[model samples]
Structures are given as structure tokens and as C-alpha cells.
Target: MDEVITAADASITGSKSSIIPYNLPLLSAFLSCALAQFLKLFTTWYKEKRWESRRMLSSGGMPSSHSSTVTALAVAIGFQDGTGGSTFAIAVVLACVVMYDATGVRLHAGRQAELLNQIVCELPPEHPVSSVRPLRDSLGHTPLQVFAGAVLGCIVAYLMSSS
Candidate 1:
């Protein structure tokens, strides 16, 4: 497939290797998101001194997985298709929107959830709402987290291109 793989030249490797690994924008995007998510484990351990394995699968952390996934897709599209193309333009726009949402609307929503959770905790046990589960506050990322995720995504896309 033109967008996925190509035949390796026999003169270069002395063998007929068909599929060259890491030649995919989709894979690069996926790997970037996974790496960012995986990094949350180490970041949590470093910051909180706890092995929070759940961070690897949870949303809203040190690095934004949403940002990483979109950014990696954009960068990979740019690298493979050039910035002047419509595909690259679409990817860039998509990335921008995702990053903005991660840092803006979603972040504020997370803050509101935290406040609601705090209020819920202060309620008396006899109250009906007091027995409800706490709201999940970790729903979004800060600007720094988004930036870090974007940088991580760019690095991953660059590596994919070079390979």
C-alpha cells in the first residue's frame, strides 16, 4: 500500500523484505498517544511517589493523550504529505481544536467537578446526595500538559519520519 508499506530493495538489504516497520502515520499517532499515557505512570510515581498504574489508562494527566494523538497525526501528515496539502491542513486544524479543548473547556469542567466533589464530601451522611459518588476531576489537561503532549507527539512523528 502506498500509504502504509513498500517493498524493500534487494540491493540494499540483500534480502526481499516486504514490509518496513514504522512507516505509518496512523501507527505514529497511536504510539504517541500510548507513550504519553504510559508516561503518566512514571510522572505520577515521581510526583506523588505512588505507582498509579491507573494513570496509564485514565484521562487527564501530566501529558494530554488527546493532544498527543492529534498532534502526532498532524505532524505525521505534514511530514508525509507536506504542509501545503489539504490533508495536512485538515490534520493541523484537527490538532488545534483538540489541544484547545483539552486546555480550555475540558479543564474548566474538571475544576467545576472538583468543586462539586468537595461540596458533596461536606454533606451529611443522612443527605441523599452525600451518598452519591464523588465527581471525577481529572477530565482535562493544563496548558503545560498540552504543550508537553504536543512536543512528545512531534518527537514521535519525527522519529517515524526518519525511520
Candidate 2:
């Protein structure tokens, strides 16, 4: 009876140890976002020498928050499921779509916004208000941005799973 009880307990504990919860993916996503934002704050502070100064929340900066978030999700999914598994494959495809959108579609839009802003600035103050529009110049992830995001995501996911 004692041996049976001990074996049952060991089996239960082993099952628990092997089971990874679903929240890990969400946590990875949140951490990536947080890390990117914190990096932005740190970079701003370093550049301006003021902890209180806030740079405009940019879309395309070092480490690319969008890339970070999605890649982190993918990495976490991969950890929960093997890389060749269906869940991991889906996550990878989704991440690719998001990264492409960030670097391609949104980037061109930002450039267009910059051009329109310049055109508006050259206009007279008395010109119609319709001529004025805010410019969004930070919209594309550089190679470095994507790379940093991938590295950050992989490291975070691995650590989260291991812990």
C-alpha cells in the first residue's frame, strides 16, 4: 500500500511538471512589449539626460516592439509545442505577417505622412486646416530592429518556459 501511494504521487508530480500552462504565451507577449517600452524609456533618458522626458511612442525603433511582441508569442508557442507542431507553425506564420506589415505597409504610410507634413509646413498659416496633419515617421523595423526583437523573444520565451 505504501509503495503504491508513493508511485501514484510521483506520477502525479511528473504529469504536473510536464504540463505547460496556456498563460505562458500571453506572458511572453506582455514581457516583450514591456521590455521594448522600457528600452525606449532608457534610450530616451540616455539621449536627453532627463528621466522625465518622454519621446513620442514610436512604431519603429530599436528592437521593434511589434516584432518583439509577436515573435515572443511565437517563441512561447514553440516552447509549449515543438517547433514542427501545428501550434508553432501557426504562430510562425502569424508572426511573419505582422512583421511584414510593420516593415512594409506601415513604413510607406509613414513616409507619405512625412511628405504631407512637409507640404503642409510650407503652406501659409492662413491656409485651410485640412492642410495640416500630424506626421508619423517611425513605422519600419530595420534589420537590427527585427534581429533584436527575435533575440529578445527567444531568450524571454526560453527563460519563461524553463522557470
Candidate 3:
């Protein structure tokens, strides 16, 4: 009869574990972020009718990469560990904080940057501020963007977990 190796036994025996099994949650989160960023590029191309490679690296777009990453981590944790587990709880709280910051504080900060840039643009050309580069106007996501990212994260995590 074949012996069944439990997780604890396998660990104590120093058996090598596959990377995917050991790091599925982290992999899910990273993949979610990458997917969201890639989608941003397409979304921008679709709406603006111009391809912007910067969208692949920039923050604040149709879907929130930050939200997608954290939400995927949370959902992945919930799947691997029970939803009621402490790890899942921590993941959930972290996700909430990130999503809130993306949609609220960071969003407002981006707006403030836009206003500041506008003010700087109105200044005299000789002014020191006028010579400085404008603050990045797209630094955070809208609520709808965050929501879409959350949904995408959950879906990705669930699909990854099932496999």
C-alpha cells in the first residue's frame, strides 16, 4: 500500500513542493495586477483611439491594479485557507484598505494634482513653478474602476484556485 504524505509530514521530511502549490496566492495577486495593467492599455486604446504603452506601466485607469492585486490576494487566501480563517481575515482587511485608498484618498489626490497643474499652467512663463513638470493627473482609480478591479480579482483568484 502507498503511504499518504500529509502536508506537515512532507514539510518535516524535506520533500520538495512545487512552486505553484506553495505560492498560488502570491502568483494570483501578481497575475491579477498584470492583467489589470494590460487591460488598461487596451481600454485606453479603445477609448482614445490611440495606443499608449505607458498605460501598461501607469496607475489609475479603467480598472484599478492596486485593487485587483489586493483583492486577488484576499480571495486566494480565502480559497486556500477557509474564508473564516485568520489569514483570510487579514487579507480581507488589507484589501479593503487598499481599495478605499485607491477610490477615495488617492483619487482626491489625483484631482488635487490636476488642479495644481492647472494653476501652474496659468502662471507666468518666467515663474519657477511653470518650468517644473506637471504632477501626474492619473494617480488613482474611480469607484467604478475599483469595483471592476475587485470583480476581476475575485474571478481570477477563484479560477486559479480551482485549477
Candidate 4:
């Protein structure tokens, strides 16, 4: 663990002793996303009263992984390049777009899928649509989830920068 951290520090300084190259922005983004997804396991268990290991790889959970990823990247870029740079501006725009889509279009689409699934289940067996598979209903996040993800991502970026 210490060695890995040393390597990361070395990488930032462009030191010859670095065991491997590491980019703080990329690392922050990935770690934030992974932590958000991993946290879904506990969140799901709290809400559903069951342990679901698959939540680590699933979407539409308490904290939005998509939001976490983008937010971390944006915050890290801002820290590295300064908020006034074109790179930081681009990153912030991208994060906003992604987070908005997650809560807006994707959330509504998931709700629609849930309604469609209910309708499909009620259809008569002879109906052509009765045999169709149900659409996935867990495809987006709530505003709270997005907010939590953003917070988590910001924390990750801060931690990475301090390291």
C-alpha cells in the first residue's frame, strides 16, 4: 500500500523512481466510481432487506456511479489545471451534462419501463406482448443519489490532490 502511494507521488513529480505511471485525475475518478458502486451493496441491503453482491456492478443505486465518475474527473481537473482553464471548463460541462441526464432523461425512462413492465404483466396470456420480457426499470438515479455521488467524488478528488 505504501509503495503504491509512493509510486503515485513519484508519478506526479515525474520522478524516475516511480514504479508505474499514475494520473491523479484518472485515479480519483475511478476510485470514486468504485467506492460509490461498492456502497450500493449496503444501501440496497438497508432499503430492500437483502444482501445483493451484484450491486457493486449495477447502476441506479443510492449514489450514482456515473455522477461520481464524472464529478471526480471534473474536480480533479479543476484542482490540477485551475478553474479558469479550458480543460477545467470542459470537464465541468461534461459533468453537468452527465449528472443531468442521469436524473432527468434516464430517471423518467426507468419509470416508463417500470410502468410498461406492470402493463405487460397484466396482459392476457394470449396477447402478443404477454410473452415479451420486461424492460429494465433500474436504469437511473434520484436527485439525492446524484448529490451523494457528487459529494463523494469531490471528497475523492480532494484526497487524491492532497496525496
Candidate 5:
């Protein structure tokens, strides 16, 4: 009886050890976001003619980090669990929703912010509202930016999964 119990304990421990140490989908998503954010730095430098490290931490850039993250997660799930699986289906749905939000609602909000900032700039200096900080005008990405992010995410996930 003791021998049987000891063998069972060893088997459980061995099985635990054999389990994957990292969640591949999650890692792929995070890495995709990080890469997108990092790339923003270079894009900003190119367009502004000056390096701006803050772009790495800011939202709404040349490539949408939100799109990259969701796309990467979906692609990773598809690669690991098969495109026909329910998990992959869910990931696809989520990615679509996120991409839509980035290009639709958030894009509109960014435009509104720009307009509001312009209005604020015209206000008198002594106006109480004029003393407030300007709204952020880069809260979302263009359609092209979203597409670029999605492509980058897919590439990243594919490379990670293939290896």
C-alpha cells in the first residue's frame, strides 16, 4: 500500500513538471503589444524628426497596440488549438470587436479631442475652462494603422508558434 501511494505521488509530481511552463497565447499577445509600442518610438522619430520615448508609453500611434495584442492572441490560439476549435473562434470574435473599437469609437473620440483642444485654444486666458489641460488628441489609430498592427501581430504569432 505504501509503495502504491509513493508511486502515485511521484506520477503526480512528474505530470506537473511536464505541463507547459508558459501560456503561449498570452506571451505572444504581450510580446506583440510590446513590439508595437516600441515601434511607435521609431515612427514618431521619423515623422517628428526627433526621438520621443514617451510614444512607447502613449496610446494611439502609427500601429495600434490594441489591434496587435488582440490579433496576436487570436493568431496564437488558432495556431496552437487549430482554427476550427472553439477557443480560436472566441479569439477571432474578440479580435474583431477590439479592432472595430480602435477604428470606430476611439477614432471618433480622438477627433473630438482635437476639436475641443482647438476651441480651448481660442478661449481667453482668464477663462476658467481655458486653464484646464488640453484633451489628448491621439486616442485612437487610423484604419491603415490598425491594419499594419494586425499584420505585425499575425507575423509575430506565426513566428513564435512555428518555433
Candidate 6:
């Protein structure tokens, strides 16, 4: 009869032990999220002072947060995985979806809110009070807004990751 050794048992008898635990993908994802958010806040605050003559907690200015977040993620993925890799491809698709939703869906939402606010003001006091506040003016990004955000995100990610 031939003796058989199990693969698991054979591996247990192996000479060397190796341990390596590093997940670059998850790290990159988190970094992208943080960088994007921080940039958005900073840019908004800057715009308030630069153009609006006020400092606000939130405002729509030059770049859209929506664009910044996705652009950061996409650039980060490209840094982590090669630009030609599947991971980067997935990130690109996700970025496109986010940008589209921001510009198309949210843009209309803002416009609707503006119209609603105007209508509410024109109504008599007998109308039910709209407890809800006006929709924020900064919901959507113009093409310039999107472009600025994308550029900012790309620069940040490249600078941080390259270092």
C-alpha cells in the first residue's frame, strides 16, 4: 500500500514561516475619501471669503464636492493600481456615475428648490407653512466647477501618493 501525506500536514512541516499583511487597496480608498472631503470644505470656505464676502459652513463655489470626491478616488486608484488595470477601470466608471448624478440630478433638485421658494413667498399667510428650508444653492456644479474639482483632486492625490 502506498502512504499518502495530506497537503496541509506537509505544509505544517515546512521550514520557514512568513507573515505579510498589507492591504493597499483599502488604504487608498480611505485616503481618497478623506482628501476629497477636506479639499471640498477648504475650497468652499475660501470661496466665501474670496467672492461672497462671508464665511459659511457650506456653500457652492468654484469646485463641486461631488466632483472632488470621485476624482480623488479615481486618481488614487490609478496611483495604487496601474491606470490600465481593472481596478482603475472600475474606479473610472464609478467616478463617471457620481459626476453625472451630481450635475444632472442634483442640479435639477436645486432649481426645483429655487422655484418652490419663490412660490412659497408669493403665497398668502393662509398657506401651510413650509417648515422645510430652501434647498441649498450649491447642490450642483457647473462645468467649470467640475473641472476645477477634478484638477484639485488629481493634484492632491498625485502629490500625496508620490511622496
Compute each candidate's TM-score over C-alphas: 0.86, 0.76, 0.87, 0.88, 0.88, 0.66
lDDT of 1 at 137: 93
- lDDT per prediction? 0.89, 0.77, 0.91, 0.92, 0.92, 0.65
In candidate 5 the C-alpha lDDT for residue 160 amounts to: 92
Name the lDDT value of residue 74 in candidate 3: 95
Scored by Cα lDDT, where does model 4 land?
0.92
* Model 2 regions more than 4 Å off: 1-22, 45-58, 129-131
lDDT of 3 by residue, 67-139 (tens): 9999999999988888988899899999999999998889999999999999999999999889989999898
Off by over 4 Å in 5: 1-20
- As a TM-score, model 5 comes out at 0.88
Query: What range of 10 consecutive residues in model 3 has the weakest lDDT sum?
Result: 13-22
Off by over 4 Å in 4: 1-20
What does candidate 3 score in Cα RMSD to the true structure?
4.7
In Å, residue 146's CA in model 2 sits off its true spot by 2.1
Ranking by lDDT: 4, 5, 3, 1, 2, 6
Model 3 clash pairs?
none
User: What are the per-residue Cα lDDT tens digits for candidate 2 across 60-116?
Assistant: 666778788889899999888779888889889998998888778877887888888
For residues 1-163, could you state the per-residue lDDT of candidate 4 as single tens digits?
Answer: 3545565686677745566656888999999999999999999999999999988987798999999999999999989888999988888999999999999999999999999999999999999999998998899899999999999999999999998
- The lDDT of model 2 is 0.77
Enumerate clash totals for all models, in the order shown: 0, 0, 0, 0, 0, 0
159: Cα error in model 5, Å: 0.7
Query: lDDT score of model 3?
Result: 0.91
